[model samples]
Target: MKALVFGADGFEDLELFYPYHRLKEEGITTHVASMKKGPITGKHGYEITADIAFKDVNSADYDIIVISGGKGPEKMRLDKDALEIVKNFFKKNKPVASICHGPQVLVSADVIKGRKATCWIGIRDDIIAAGAQYEDSEVVVDGNLVSSRNPGDLHAFGREMIKLLK
Candidate 1:
């Protein structure tokens, strides 16, 4: 299996790197893609040099796409390219995993309509407003989607993601 991790900038480091290493350990090739080509800073001021730019990723090349959450979501939501990359996965029926404030982008992409998911409590209204159903669970699995509340739920998040990938 192959995975796409989308983090524009200011993403939570644990949110992106945890599953990234998990995929690698399981022999699932991973690609880190974002809007720009160089280093994208994390919320804690850590720099994650992306392995691929959004312009280079094709939905057909990955089996799953994981989007991390952070303050970046507020700005990244307005990025058409990031939104399109996410929508393509759902349109193709590939699994898409998002957490925390990450729902902002998925909802902005218009791919969450009628699907059940979870996100940061603050964004519950945003998810609902996007035409998707919300479950107040730490993790909710709806079809090809998986979501969790925050970094504290990363354990469940990674487990659920691995289950779906398998």
Candidate 2:
């Protein structure tokens, strides 16, 4: 299995790293992609090198897509290529896991409308505005999409994703 994780500068470190490592532990080959190739810093000062650039990602190559939240989503939502990638994952009905501000990209992709989801409290209004049923739970899994409020919910988020993959 192959997984694609998308993030940029200021991404929540745990949100990205936990799932990345968890997926690998499950024997899933994972690739980190950002707008640029090379290292991207997290909000907490940790850095991760992106394996590929956003322009090079083809959703068809991935079995699952992970969107990690933080300040990064504020910028990634404005990226057409990133939105396209998100849309393709949904279009293909592949598993998608998004945490915190990550839903902003799904909102931009227009795939969560009428779907149940969870995200950071700060973006609760945005999630509603995008037409999704907002849940305040630690995690919400609707069909192929799994969403969590923040790093605190990573355990449930990762568990649900792995369950779906199996």
Candidate 3:
């Protein structure tokens, strides 16, 4: 399966690397589509170079879209193009998984208005306002959408994603 992982400049390092490595173990092809092509620093001061530019990735080519979050969401949620990409993928019925503050993008996309999802506690209100039913569980899967509370929830998130990809 082909997966598109989206991260802007300050995403959680673990959120990005863990899923990327886990997906590879399942023989899934995952691409890092970010706002820029060069190295982007993570919330913890780690830097990762993106593999593909967001504008260069087409939704039709990917099986699922994963959006990771952290300190970046506070700024990323305001990006029009990124929001559009989330809406487009959701509208197409492609699977989507968001972690930490990543749900903010879905909220901005206006796609979570009635979906059940999980995200970091601080952002639950934002998710609810965006039209989703927020859950406090470690992981929540509503149809094609999956989410987790934080980095510690990565195991469940990765397991769920592998099932979805399979």
User: What's the true lDDT of residue 137 in model 1?
Assistant: 85
Candidate achieving the largest TM-score: 2
> TM-score, each model?
0.94, 0.98, 0.93
- Evaluation by lDDT, superior candidate among 1 and 3: 1
Model 2 bad stretches (over 4 Å): none
Question: Which digits, one per residue and each the tens of the lDDT, describe model 1 over residues 1-166?
Answer: 7888888678988898888888898999998887777888898887887888777777788999898888767877787777888888888778888999989988889888999999999999989999989988889999899999899999999999999977
lDDT winner, 2 or 3: 2
Q: Please list the Cα RMSD from the true structure of every candidate, rounded to 1 decimal place.
A: 1.2, 0.7, 1.3
Question: How does each model score on lDDT?
Answer: 0.86, 0.92, 0.83
TM-score of model 3 vs. true structure: 0.93
Candidate 2, residues 24-140, lDDT tens digits: the string is 999999999888889999999999999998788877889998999999888888888888888888888889999999999999999999999999999999989999999999999
Name the candidate, 2 or 3, with the larger TM-score value. 2
Backbone clash tally (model 1): 0
Which segments of model 3 are wrong by more than 4 Å? none
- Model 3, span 1-166: residue lDDT tens: 7887887778899998888788777788888877767778888887777788766767778888888888766666776766777888888877898999888888878899889999999988878877789889989998889999999999999999777766
